[model samples]
Target: MMIRIRSRDGLERVSVDNPAATVAELKFAIESQLRVPVHAQILSTNQNLLLAKAPGDLNKFTDMLDPNARVSALGISHGSIVFLAYEGERTVAGPAFHPSGSFGKKMTMDDLIAKQMRITRQENPHCELVSFDRDAANAFQHYVNESLAFAVKRGGFMYGTVSEEGKVEVDFIYEPPQQGTEDNLILLRDPEEEKFVEAIALGLQMRKVGFIFTQTISQDKKDYTMSNAEVLQAVELHAEGDLKEWVTAVVKLEVNEDGGADVHFEAFQMSDMCVRLFKEGWFETEVKGEIDPKLSRMKKDVVVGGKDVTSVDNDFFLVVVKIFDHQGPLATTFPVENRRIPVSPGALRSHLDRSRNLPFVKRISDFHLLLFLSKYLDVNSDVPALSGCVRAQATVPEGYQLLIESMASAC
Candidate 1:
C-alpha cells in the first residue's frame, strides 16, 4: 500500500508493505524512507495541525502513543494522505564545502561581512500603485464573501499590465487549481488551465502581473496582518513571476470595534531588497509552529508614503504600496474557479438552449464553466480546438458549439 505524505518540503509517497503494520512501524518506515527521525516526527491525519499548533501543546494526537495499534485500525489506509510536522533539522552527511563550488574558495573578512549584511529599505516601488479593475475586484471579493464566507483561504494570480505612471491595472484574475484551508493554501496547477489563461492574456494583451488572496476572518483577531507562512508564500509567488511591477494583494474581513465585518483590501509589491534577499537565500524558508511577528519584518521602503521603514510598525502589512480601482472587460456574472456557484439542472439546460444562437467560446465566457465542459470534451481535439478560439479570440465553429452546449445541457 502506498500513502501520500505532505510536509513543508512538499508531497512524497511512502510504501507500507504490511496492511496490519502498527503506528510505530509506520513511523519507522517514514524515518527510513523519508529521512525524518522517528522521535522528531509528529504525524497526523489533520492538516490544520500540521502547520498551526496551539500553544503549550506539543503532541496534539495520542494515536501514535500506542505503538502496537494497527494503522488500518487507526483508519489509515492505502492511498490516504497524511500530514507530517517535525522538530529540529534533518542532518545531512556531506562534505563541508566542495573545493570546486562557488563557496569553496572563500576569501577575506570583507567577503563574509558582505554576505551577512542585512537587507536595507528601498526608496521607491517599481509599481507606483496597483489599481484593481472594479469588476475583477468585485468578482474575486464576491466569491470570498458570498461563497467562502471568510471561512477559508483562497488565492489567485492577477493578470493585467502596468501603466506609464507606474500604476498596475489588473484586468482579470486566473486562479490555479489549489487546496485552501484556514491556515494553508496548496497550489495544484493544471497545464491545460494555464494554457487557457495564456490564451486569454494573449487576447487581452495582458500578462501575469500580481497575486491576490483572501484571509479568513479568524485572522483579524491575530496581531499581524499577514502570518510568516503567508508572507513566505506570497514572496515565493512574487519571486516566481520575475516581474518588477509584481503586486501582492490581500483581502480580508476586518471586524470594526462595533463587531461588524468590513471587507478590507490591501496591496503591496515586494521591495527590490526583499526579492533580492529571497533570490539570494537570505530569508528563512522553514516556518513551523507559532510564527513570531518579528520574523516577517524587514527594513524596506515602500511607495505608500515612501519612507525608510525600520520594522513593520503597523498591522496593515510589511511592504504595502497603495491601492486604486479601474474597470475591466470581463463581467462578474459567471462563477470562477475555487468559487461555489449554485447551478441548477434547469438553469444549465436553459443556458445551453439560449447559447445555441451564439458561438461555443462566447457561450461560455466563464473559465469555471469551461473547466466543467472540459471533462466531457475530447482532450486532443475538442479541448485544443476550443482553446484556440480563446487564443485567437476567434469565433467558435458551429459543430464544436453544438457538441459543447449539448454536453453542458446534459450535465
Candidate 2:
C-alpha cells in the first residue's frame, strides 16, 4: 500500500508493505524511506494539528500515537494524504558529483551570471493596485469591530476581478469557518459554504484574488508589521492560489501618540523569488532562535533600476498598493463566521418586531445568520426559498419565519 506524505518540502509517497503495521513500524518506514527521523516526525490527519508532538492529546479524531497501535486502525490507509511536521534537516542520498564530467563541472562566469539573474527579486507587480469596495469593507469591519472588538484575529477571502489596467477590485468577502486566537487563526473550511461562494463568484464574474486578515491590537507593540507566523500563512496562501496578482492585506488599529486608535490598512504581495524559494524548500521551517526579519531578504547584489540589491530589501514583500473604497454588493447579517452572535429566537423576533418600520429583507440582511439557518433548513426547499426572498427583496413567508424562529429557540 502506498500513502502520500506531505511536508514542508512538498509531497512524497512511501509504500507500506504491511496493511496492519504498528505506529512504530510506520515511523521506521518514514525514517528509512523519507529520511525524516522518527523522533522528529509529527504526523496527523488534521493540517492544523500537524505540528503537535502527540495530536491525539489535542484532538480525539487524531490517532497518531501509541507506538504499538496498528496504522490501519488509526485510519491511515493506502492513498491517504497524511500531514507531517518534522524538526531538523533531512539529507538526501543521491549520486556524487564529479568535477571531471560536464554534469559536475565548476562554475563559470556565465553560470554565475545566470544564477544571479534567476535569484533576483521581481520589482513590478502583476496588479497595479487593489481597491476595496466601501460597502464590503464596511460590512466586514463593522462586524469585527462591534462583535469581536479587535481583541482577536479574523480572516476572510476577497472575491473580485482584475481590470484590464491591472487594477484589482475587491467587492465581497467570504468568511470561512475558522478558529482564531490573539496570534493564530486556523481555517476550518465548510464544503457547502465554499460551493455557495463559488456559485456567487461565478454569477458576479469574479474570482478569489486576495486574503484579508486582522492583527490584534496587542501586536502593535511588536516591531514588525507582520509576524513570522503571519508571513508563513501569507506565503502559503499566495503560493497555493498561484495567482500572479494575489494580494495579502492586513487590517489593524494603530495607536496614535495621543492614545487614540486609528484603523490602518496595509497591502502587500509576496515577491516571485519568495514563492519560488518556498516551493523549493529553501526555508528552514524550524527556527532555533528568534525569527530574523532579514533572513528572507536578499544578501546578494542584483542591479535593478541601477541600484544594488541593498536598495530593495528581499523581505518577501513587494510593492505596497494604495487602497481606495467604492460601493459594493453585500450586506452584513447574523451568525458571523468564527464569532459567536448571542441571539435567541425570542431575541431575534423582538428585534424584528421593533424594526417593523424596515423592510423584511433589510431586517434579515445578515448573511452569516442565514448561513447558520441553512444547516437546519431543507436544502432543496427552505434554503432556496429564503435565498430567493433575500435576492428579490421580497418579504419572507410567515411559515418560513416561524420555522427559523422555532429552530433558533430549540438551540
- lDDT of each structure? 0.68, 0.68
How would you encode candidate 2's per-residue C-alpha lDDT over 1-411 as one tens digit per residue?
888776554446778899988878878888989788898877776654433447454454346867888878868888886766676766433323221233323334333342233344566777899999886777677766767878888899988888888788997787887887987878888887776665445534578999999988788877676765676677788998768889988888888899898777888888777676567654554433454643443334444543435223334355566677776544653435545754454545554555668776666654555655666666656666676676567788998877865764554
Angstrom error of the Cα, residue 79, model 2: value is: 53
Q: Which parts of model 1 have CA positions greater than 4 angstroms off?
A: 1-110, 113-116, 297-317, 339-363, 370-400
Highest TM-score against the true fold, candidate: 1
Q: In angstroms, what RMSD does candidate 2 have relative to the true structure? A: 20.0
How far out, in Å, is residue 249 in model 1? 0.5
Query: Can you write out model 1's per-residue Cα lDDT over 133-186, one digit (the tens) per residue?
Result: 888788888878988898888999998887788788887787777888988878
10 residues in a row with least lDDT, candidate 2:
95-104
lDDT of 1: 0.68
- Candidate 2 TM-score, true structure as reference: 0.57
Cα-based RMSD of the predictions, in order?
22.2, 20.0
